[model samples]
Target: MTNNSTCNPLLLGNQLCFPLYASARKIVAAYNPFLKEIGLTYPQYVTMMVLWEEKKITMHDLGKRLYLDSGTLTPVLKKLENMGYVTRSRKPEDERVVIVEITPEGQALREKAEKVPYAMGCLINRKGNLFTPEEVETLKKQLYRLIHALE
Candidate 1:
């Protein structure tokens, strides 16, 4: 067999998205155990993080911040509501709009969740320092740029 790189644009190694996708999956997986300890899944945890910061926001705004669509976000919100971590209600002025708010339970969870970032940072830097803090920041900025470009 002959190797001809030019002949195959479909090759996984030739695509930028493949590595980004793989790395995202791996990072999310790495967060699982830590998230599980707090009784939240990765998506729910991220949602709560935003709610924790904002205290309360419209469902539309929450979805935009998380880059998730209603189809995806609705179930997550529902689960959080069921878990008594959040509440969802229609906006009084606009019945079309929905709002999400964190409960006191959810607020209390923040103390436990506060350690997650430190733990993940330790894991990332554990094996001979996979990336320096500066490198990580640069990579994060670049990824956000890519996301913005795509949007």
Candidate 2:
């Protein structure tokens, strides 16, 4: 029987998972400077993504769209509200349901946020930016497939 344990020491760089995870983290960290300038974190940016697509949506719907739960979103929404970017309230039609709506301030912030993609584009340009567009597309597709498959 092959003694797999006798294989070469687990060189982190040689392991796809380690390097891949570190690379992802490093890239996300690279975005920190820019994101900080805009007062948003990675998770916050994702939340803005769905909110940008839908002017107003229920917390439940937002959670579903963002793959987040109330525990994660509640504070994020509160922060946005405190920043005057969004408004959260119980739905008049369904008091049981909470709704979130972006304000003019939020829309204006969206306009400001329009530059983030450009900023991120420049950072991803390392290695001639080989991993930027291509990998993003492929990874999104693969992750989507995995998410659906696992579901």
Clashes of each: 0, 1
Give lDDT tens digits, candidate 1, residues 41-83.
Answer: 9999999999999999999999999999999999999999999
Per-residue lDDT of candidate 2, residues 38-110 (tens digit): 8998888777778888989999999988778899999999998898888999988889999999888887878
Q: How accurate is candidate 1 locally (lDDT)?
A: 0.94
Best candidate, TM-score: 1
Which one wins on lDDT? 1
Off by over 4 Å in 2: 1-20, 132-135
Cα shift from native, residue 18, model 2 (Å)? 4.2
- Candidate 1, residue 121: Cα displacement in angstroms equals 1.2
Global Cα RMSD, each model: 1.8, 3.4
User: Which 10-residue window of candidate 1 scores lowest in summed lDDT?
Assistant: 1-10
Cα RMSD for predicted model 2: 3.4
